[model samples]
Target: VYADNDPIVLVHAQTLLNSSAEGRTAYIRADVNEPDTILRSPGLIETLDLTKPVALSLNALMHFVTDAQDAHGIVRRLMGALPSGSALALSHCTPDFDPQTWQKVTDIYHRAGTPVRFRDKAAVADFFTGLDLIEPGIVVGHRWRPSAEDGGAAGEDGGAAGEDGGAAGEDGPAPSDADVSLWVGVGIKP
Candidate 1:
């Protein structure tokens, strides 16, 4: 299901997905913390077949789901709603490489009323419990499945790739781990 707690985000997502020339698309303005809301949404019901596998993408989101909300339990509940063979593609902000920088960033976000809690790799791996991780499990975002140009190696800090279309920028070298602080992985329900 295509869901986001923010109505504006859902509007944009709906617009973008519905614009696709092929395939059916629907949107759900629901919170991830309430897995049943998303799983039972009429929009999702109309768009997807629960009897079949689904591809769930939780990109750049989990870090916002703080421990107070039981983020791991929320993920498990959501994923459990899907059938076997369902895929989960997730990306999360991490403090494993640069705890100081990420901590400052988290404070900034918290001040803005958007609290964030960066996790270590092992903590993020916990989200995929009961699911089989794909190749290059829980690596830096761009290193999950790099092209030949990325040196076919796992990323370390900002040296591997940047969020800006994988370009390191013209003025500086690749980013440091402190700068590019996100981990990504894909997994499948067995």
Candidate 2:
């Protein structure tokens, strides 16, 4: 099951909801802060088994939630619902590398009425406090298994600079840490 608060996301997700006979897909319009509402969603309950491990992916999402929203608490509550061995795969924007640029970005987001907060490394680490962090711990998004050979962190998506071994400008000179201020990590519930 996929959950997103945006109706537009749900609209886009609708086209991809067609699962093969051997599979299943469900999308719920739910907010991240409201963990209980999301946990009790019919679409989620129908699609996922609470008894089994579930991978909760929150890529490029937490940045939209501000400190006042208790972003870390939301993560804990969501992960708390899953059985042990469940994993949380997350990536968040950070201001550690280029604070001035990120401040401008934050202002832009705020002007547009979207809550935004760029946390430092330690603050981001707090999200995985109770869980066991996987190897590489927290790092720049591209540095996570970055390789030109693997197409990972190689392109605009999240590849290392020039590591993709692609033609000139193919990956666009590799994304700098400041350009892609995203921090990514995975942790398993104990």
Candidate 3:
């Protein structure tokens, strides 16, 4: 399932429909703010199995939600609806290091009809509430379990980058300068 405030749902629905030949597909045009609109819709409730393990992704999207909407609260509500073993994968823009740049980015979004609320590392961690984080807890996107394909300074271990680049721990995969500003993590429900 996918949710977005924009009307691009039709485009994504069409793409999925065109790609899927053996499986069934459905699209619900709704905003994340009003999850009940999709949850309570006819056929949707009966179609998806809430008991099964599901991956809820919030990739580059949560920043659009402001504090008034209770972004973290909304995530908690969605996670609570799913049964145990459900996983949440999220990638959020962080302002932990460069506040000035982040502020400018936020301002740009403000002018473009959408408000961007970039959170720091700790603030982003708060969204995972009661879930168990997988290894390499809360690091830059590219630094999370990097593969050989990612060209960068490799450490003695298979992880990306090295101690000189700021990723120090055994599992710490040093991130490129640009990637050092973003925060990404995955958590599994118990």
Q: What's the number of clashes in each of the models?
A: 5, 7, 0
* Residue range 16-135, candidate 3, lDDT tens digits: 653245654556677777767766765456556777988788888888888898899889888888889999999899877778888888898899988778998888999898999987
The better candidate by TM-score, 1 or 3, is 1
Model 2, range 75-168, lDDT digits (tens) per residue?
Answer: 9999999999999999999998899999999999889998898899999999999999986778787677666464433445433445432223
Off by over 4 Å in 3: 18-22, 152-159, 163-180
lDDT of 1 by residue, 83-180 (tens): 99999888999988777878888889999999777899898999899999988777776555665465433345332445432445356555554566
Kindly provide the TM-score of model 2 when superposed on the true structure, using C-alpha atoms. 0.87
Each prediction's TM-score against the native?
A: 0.85, 0.87, 0.82
Clashing pairs in 2: 148-163, 148-164, 153-158, 153-159, 153-160, 154-159, 161-174
Better of 1 and 2 by lDDT: 2
Better structure of 1 and 3 per lDDT: 1
Best model per lDDT = 2
* Clashes in predicted model 1: 5
- Model 1: C-alpha RMSD to truth? 3.9
Supply the TM-score for candidate 1: 0.85
